[model samples]
Target: MRLVIARCSVDYAGRLSAHLPLATRLLMVKGDGSLLIHSDGGSYKPLNWMSPPCTLEVGVPDDDAREAGVDAVWTVTHKKTADRLTVSIHEVLHDSEHELGVDPGLQKDGVESHLQKLLAEQIERLGDGYRLVRREYMTAIGPVDILATDADGASVAVELKRRGDIDGVEQLTRYLELMNRDPLLAPVQGVFAAQEIKPQARTLAEDRGIRCVVLDYDDMRGVDSGVPTLF
Candidate 1:
């Protein structure tokens, strides 16, 4: 990971155009070939970022840019989308790189962890021929809760959440996008499974062609849910 604090201006070009006027910001270039520009103050979210599967080129500024006080320029281009994020540096305050090895990934809390385990055990709950590929399937960004295959043998990525919300859907979307890029998983599908799903999240998931599943925790564990059900 490389971190640089510099005075720079940023421009994003592609589906949309955006610009960040000259200012001092933190520029992060991760080992995965992604770049993120962040201001000192803001939510954890970066002011702007280029997702992985991208390339970065560093070059000296043009004559015009040099005359305008620009020192260097960094161009980041997305391999798939062709979107470009360009940063024109005026001055560098700090720069450093660190070699952080493989991450162990996030640890799920007890309930969420158990939910994943139960779902993996009852893989058929997804459908007639659904089979578990693996739990905590590692991806570039993070581990997908579960990776499975459906009746047709197509890849299915399941994201388990205690309560499904927009964020969970978004996370699953990212995983699906990345997975679909693989030739072996070209047509990967997504399932957002949770004990309860928010209406907004359900709508978003469906709009993206992802399926949603509500897991009955007790039933999966062979324990009574205590809610009356018609036999």
Candidate 2:
């Protein structure tokens, strides 16, 4: 992991354009090659970022950039796309690198964790004859939220999120890709289950032949027990 604190201006060019004026911010270049720029304060969210599978180039600013007050520049280009992010540093306040090795990922808790537990208990919510095999099913990449079998006995991998976004779809896609390679789970299917799925995410999931399920947390919690059902 590489961390840098610098007074920099940022610009992104790809499907969209964004600019960040010169300011002191934390620059994170993750193990996966993703890069993030964060201001001094904000809940973990980066002011700007470039997703993984990108190349990074660092060098002194060119004549044009030098004249514009850019002391150094970092360019990140996505491997599979033309998306680019450039950070023009006016001055670096601090810089350090650490060999953190592979991260174990996050341990979710609170409402999200409880929600996953409840969903595991209510496997039938998936559909008739659906049975949960296990929660936090271990995989080489990471643990899947829930593993289940559909009526036809095919494996089903479910990814739970509070709000389903494009990234959630991507995550599920990766899990499904890995899971499907196993002979035992050769024909696995994927489900993006969340309280509310964004339209864009739903479209992406569907495009990949994955299903999207909208969860009603209140009902899942038995908050409206008076509303009886056939379940």
Reference-based lDDT, each prediction:
0.95, 0.92
In model 1, the Cα lDDT at residue 155 comes to 95
Compose the digit string of candidate 1's lDDT tens values, residues 1-231: 999999999999999999999999999999998999999889798999999899999999989999999999999999999999999999999999999999999886437889999999999999999999999999899999999999999999999999999999999999999999999887999999999999999999999999999998878888876889789
Instruction: Tell how far residue 89 is off in model 2, in angstroms.
Output: 32
List the lowest-lDDT window of 10 residues for candidate 2.
106-115
Q: Model 1: runs farther than 4 Å from truth?
A: 115-161, 164-231
* Tens-place lDDT digits, model 2, residues 36-132: 9998789899999999889999988889989988889999999888899999999888999999977798875435677789899998999999999
lDDT assessment of candidate 1? 0.95
| lDDT, residue 181, model 1 | 92
Error of 2 at 192 (Å): 0.4
Candidate 2 residue pairs in clash (backbone atoms < 3 Å): none
